[model samples]
Target: MAGRKKRAGNPSPGPSGGPGAPSPTLLVRGGWILSMAPGGFQGHGDILVREGRIQEIGPDLPRPPGASLLDASGAAVLPGLVQAHLHLCQTLFRGLAEEMELLPWLQTRILPLEAAHDEKSIAASARLALTELLLSGTTAVQTMETVHHTQVVLEVLEEAGVTAVTGGCLIDQGEGTPPSMILPAGRALEAQLSLAREWNGKRSGRVEAALCPRFALSCSEGLLRECAAASREKGLRLHTHAAENKEEIRKVREITGLSDIAFLDGAGILGPATSLAHCVHVSPEDRARLRDRGVHVVTCPSANLKLASGIAPAAEYLDQGINLALGADGAPCNNRLDPWRETRLLSLLQKVLAGPAALPPGKALETATLGGARALGREKEIGALEKGKRADMVVVDLEAPWLGPGGSPETRLVFAAGPAEVRHLVLGGKTVVRDGKFLLWDPAEAAARAREELKKLLSRAKLPS
Candidate 1:
């Protein structure tokens, strides 16, 4: 992806030419590089990026001819943040479905609103979410879209130039499910297969497809089994929610005579290729199943807390050798797509749940970066500033007075830094955000489009605007 041209007399460093032009080689010089790799953190280092991959990382590297130079003095350079679970389709519904648990939040407001989405609304929602994510230094995600018009979301993701693993929500049966959102098991599987054929490996393998079954309650046993089989056969990732709330867990046990995790396991859905979200209420047996099966767990601390769900045993999960990652969830639930907020919340919540030493700043930052990459099976390609990895990084201006100079870089990043401090975001060797402003498009225009689309969506859903 080529970057927008730098305007005349603008000191901000960016790609040299207009969009669609060849991606310029970039040399990032003189930054405190926190590589997130083993013994990789260094002060006053330079990174060489060419052909969308990191070529070298050391102090005082020679700048290649005609390469764009990003002066990173007094900044902290780190790998781009990765969000393991998100719902970009819900970006336009922020603050619209408050004071509700998971089931009600879905039945009353979220489902109907999602059911009302048209192509235009979906596009608007995607653009708005991508704008917030990119500005917040999130360069990769594992997101799920609503059932219909998922192609529109994939198209928007392509245009935004982010690595993603996404697919439509698969719901074959559930109470209060919108009629339009429901599909037969065969139809849903076929639809996902079709989506994979079209979108998987697109953008040089930046955008891939996953099998998302919504949750155990929303999907049938047959649908879950078929998804598991298909995922194993096709080498696709399986994503879903499990054991998130007490009420939801009770309902699942009462209906299926098993816990949510047990049900999914019986359906052949527990494996390394599967990523389960919100394992807040897992039993010992369930935890064993997850760890034994090598299933990745994504803990959305803000969403679980806001919906009155219990805090997850994140520190315990790490202790048990279960791969753990972080996410902000959807907009209506968390109200923000910022990974920094999630990282901070995860650390504090773990401290409260365990002890002050539980999940320290360095480990918490690793969960947000390396853990997320492992969850998406892209650890070799991203999550570090190593040679031959994709050039996905964020330059954070650490000169802010609020981030007192006493703490370590990891401490400041996990506790003090935020989106405002993210000076530049580079994805695939392209500088999409520079000097705290997006160079691809105007965020104001994206917000304006979301506002108009939200109005139309409310009208269609017959809900109060």
Candidate 2:
């Protein structure tokens, strides 16, 4: 959720459009708003939107002279969800790595498929993945994009009206298989730095560029250092995968005689600006180090399960005050990008790891919003419903069958709700989704095209659907 401002109480319904809200820009009233703040979700207030920014929010007040008010009598509003770690271009290659470990998967299934990609295939795949993410209620993504597809992916986000930190790949002495056109490490670094200069802050600070090195296995010391220096010098954020598997830890030991976390810490790239995805094998000492240095951890429970990677010690990390967020790594690995689905799985997984009551609902919701915003370094813009933030939000219809038996709206939302219940959606004050349908693009045609492309891809691999 980018922008959601809150006044203490509900604002008065603005000029009524004969009991219906008007088109394009308007005010939203009569809903139980979920501010998604530290005090837990609360809102029986009104949200005032004008020209795409939350203007006012509170209990009963004179509506804007010309604003049309839409009744939200039976809905709950929350900040739009954020995907902390995302890889859309790698989508639809699901199950390609199911039979391999993380390293072999990269060397064989994952990288080879990524290597065989062209623009048409990748773009179509990205579109399909992004649409799935949107439908699943993810409004923003910190995209770990490939070298050549970064710009196009951002364009996809832009056209889709989604918010995100889009990035290009950084590889030095790259390992495993890669496309012939994959950028040379030296060239990739220069281009990535240049790209950071151009796209790090866009969409009124909604979109950003991050420095992404494939992993420590492929990125050299010098390369990692440059990435750090570039991120620091250019003020771009650092995003990477770390300590996810046994092989990765061994590779780091072979290359640097250091553990994954320590190696990154030595590189000076494991601080508040860094967002590391999949820290499953981290030690207790590593946990303390991360907390001390203020590193952000992104837990992708789905991907880990699909790859048989161990679950992250997320509950322990949370207890240690380390900022933890959620990620849908890539569609290929995780298969989908539903923030709520991820949240539910995260809680259940953590509960299994820690205990039955390990993670509660309110905390689970935070990972998708506030925590996610913090991971993207956009805490000020997205996350919670507050004034001076982007008007990004999803309206859950509480009257539906899935929620009709709800005892508590917020609790039911986190535990029971899914795609069928998102009745309305707003982004930057625009109705990108309304009544469970997209207002921005033809999702039907998008899906049809994707199906055809998926067939071609699967046929080439002789893979079964």
Candidate 3:
């Protein structure tokens, strides 16, 4: 918060229906609402937000007195995007390990740089990542933090008024390996839990903690079991990387003689509350076990492609009834953090793996919104534009060049629009991004700070070849 200055752009005309402020009510008039309901896309309707929850939705809704109307006439009111996996603090080293595999990338590049990065740099990266997400129409994100200083990231999230589940890196090694990045994993995890107690349920349940063990190879069975026990004790979700690349999977197999899912299941870690990121190398049996155990998979398409982590068979997972969500991973690997791009890329990747008929455009939209909400267990609160639900929605400006012929909104939304096309966005009935600008955060300063850190990080690491 220290480095961040007030954004130069004028704030969103002020929040509508604010109590102390002049406006005490708001009526969002005339918008093509993509309800995300069972049938999909309530193309012509309006949403009324009285006090941060939708009060009504229909044609020509009655505008209450003292109500300020958000003129969403030319936009599609879709649910705000949810990012199920990301290391926001890693924004400083996005392209550091462009060629190395996952384990080496972490051990040689990511871990060393992250360990060296000061607290100020970590906070700067977090702020920049959150600002980019807001501009890209993300309502919530499950962000991972460096083991030592997660509070800084949570602080940045609070300052931005974003919904997020945070995880502190859990590793059990010392020097020469990624676990060396955080020695004495137990103490590190304990600190994380202590911080969790302080910040988990803050922002009116908008933020929470997840027990994050970095990966199988980076941790010992004892450490993972301890983390699972802690998660059970706290009823917190378990967030971890699982079988992201082949080398990692091979290490787990050698150590345990079990595939990824079997290893986690045997460790007594897999559960309904588990949010596993990048199940690209998971086996068929692993997929079945994941479904049976109700494990949610958060697919990071952009990062997977950039890192060559092997595209996950997301379409097959969806067909098997496994819950799926979307994430961009982080800015460096993705070179950008935008859910709109993730949604499109995830679908197209599935198509590349399977066929054109697989992973349709509308399905991709669902993965980013509804599926993501389900993955985070925030089903009741988010994932749609409906009365009685939280006012978590994004307005896609339909005036873009791709939408000129007025094709299907699902196609246009997933394929055409990136962060640039997201003109206005709202999270929990508050204006976070309007006219393509942040309401409270200054992204330019945050980005500049991150770039400065990136240069130093790259210079230190052996570039992935």
Best by TM-score: 1
Q: What tens-digit string does per-residue lDDT give for candidate 2 at 300-335?
A: 998888788889988888999999999989876777
User: What TM-score would each prediction reach against the true structure?
Assistant: 0.96, 0.89, 0.91
Candidate 2 displacement at residue 94 in angstroms: 3.3
Cα-lDDT of candidate 3: 0.77
As a whole number from 0 to 100, the lDDT of residue 269 in candidate 1 is 97
Show pairs that collide, candidate 3: 94-332, 173-179, 175-180
| Residue 461 C-alpha lDDT in model 3 | 49
Candidate 1 — what's its lDDT?
Answer: 0.89
lDDT of each: 0.89, 0.76, 0.77
Superposed Cα deviation of residue 138, candidate 1 (Å) = 0.2
RMSD per prediction, one decimal?
3.1, 5.1, 4.5
In model 1, where do residues sit more than 4 Å from their true spots?
1-22
Stretches of model 3 off by over 4 angstroms after superposition: 1-24, 39-41, 178-180, 452-465
Question: Residue 72 of model 2: what lDDT?
Answer: 64
